[model samples]
Target chain A: MIFPPDSLEAIIFNALSETVESMVFEEVVINQFVANKWPQVENSAWWACIELFPPPISGEVIIVVPDALMNRFTEATLGMGDEPPLAEENADALGELLNTLCGRLLAMRVGPTHTFRMGLPKIGRGDTMTQEGNNHKLVDCLVEDDHIYLVVPNQFWDFNAD
Target chain B: MLKILIADDSKTARMIIQRCLEMVGVANCEYVHASDGIEALTIMRAGGVDLLITDLNMPNLDGKGLLLAVKSSPKLTNTPVIVISSLVNQALEIELNSLGVNSIINKPVSPVKLLECMESIMEKGFIS
Candidate 1:
């Protein structure tokens, strides 16, 4: 249940990269993991969350991405060209992406022996963002020239009350 | 034409699975859509559904729940189900198999893999 920040960040990066490539057909590059010093963490970022299961080891994954990248992501997933973005569609795409990413990460971590049932993904505006707790681990990366941050809470804890 | 029902909360995932079915030369099939397992069960109860392709995670009634329902139904127990999900586990696989699931497909499901699974299932006398 104790995942070092650096190790969790690396896992998130790999999961993000694989999920984007397979789901949206986009080759994402991880620029670097910006630890605790992400200035662009706000910027009206779109956020998606997928909650994990199985007690003490349970935690949730939160993905934060910029608006422009989300537009491109939605377009790529639906095989569309540049156009006015549909907010709802982009949000749905992000939710599905995180679902796949979290599943892949858990499958890798648990090695297929244990089952992790992830809850449905939730998406909303960036203002919902809160300060990370002691168990929160985060990493900032660049994909398609846009910055995205991914966070996982300690022990799959639900810090936000819905 | 075969009547296949595909259930997934994500429209994109359902679309991808349908596209794969066509790519595998299941080109002459009729597709029914549902967003959750409850809807899928309702559709199946209406009868004439040749196959079921579903996702494990959904808002109302998940894939496992749907499988349990289908297996317990005397009229629908013979219908083939191919589960396509992002989640995978050895224990879950065994449970699904015991529930009479024809095949298990992982998400980001490829046309080739789906084609192989469908062909194998069809060979077992499920398809006409």
Candidate 2:
């Protein structure tokens, strides 16, 4: 594995924290309550997915966020005060966030010299999607009162057997 | 007034980069936006673009193709290019440097980092 399970968890947390804080000036903390299942939210959620291409180690990173939190993020990102952001604006914000997050995660996992490519982020609205695999990793996070999730297949780190 | 062109498929990214540039004290600049590398190249070829700040991953031509077009043109070769991308690594950095990229900034860019990179470019007289 590229990193031990604990180390992988830490990397995910750090990457998410850095990306959210810098992009939207918001802090994120790991959600300790929901261990396996996706968080139950009253509002509909939006998700953004991006594919990572590192040759033999390929995987997808998905970020899920509720509508309200996403709206807040969109407003903060566009510097919109009071005025509501357009639908396309929200999608763009989520796409950019996922793009940045995926890149940061891959860089942390593979280090400096290794080269990687990522497909454009795909954003959509849907019920919570679940990954049914033994090699899936989830990092549930709380941005203020909202629950956000970062999901990826564990095989992405199978390159390093050490 | 400086005429700066920003090329990125995401509007949010372009806005953020523009905000970062403004935050770094780059005032009195006229900004042009393009959604893809082909559009950016066309805009650059039209003239009056003082600087080009682009994202590496984009539809149509992409940043590498845009950079190649810019550097190969005798008219646009002197115009400095700064790449802001999430997919930055040692190999990509080396390749971008070889292609005459003035600066490379990672995603979720802060004003301080943008300022530092701009300052370095300013020192080299690439951008005034």
Best candidate according to DockQ = 2
| Tens-digit lDDT track of model 2 for A72-128 | 999998899888888789999999999998888877777777778888988877754
DockQ of each: 0.70, 0.81
Best by TM-score: 2
Clashing pairs in 2: none
Clashes of 1: 3
Candidate 2 DockQ score?
A: 0.81
Tens digits of per-residue lDDT, candidate 1, A82-116, equal 68568888888888888888877776555555666
TM-score of 1: 0.87
Clashes of each: 3, 0
Fraction of the true interface contacts (Cα pairs closer than 8 Å across chains) found in each model: 0.62, 0.75
TM-score of 2: 0.91
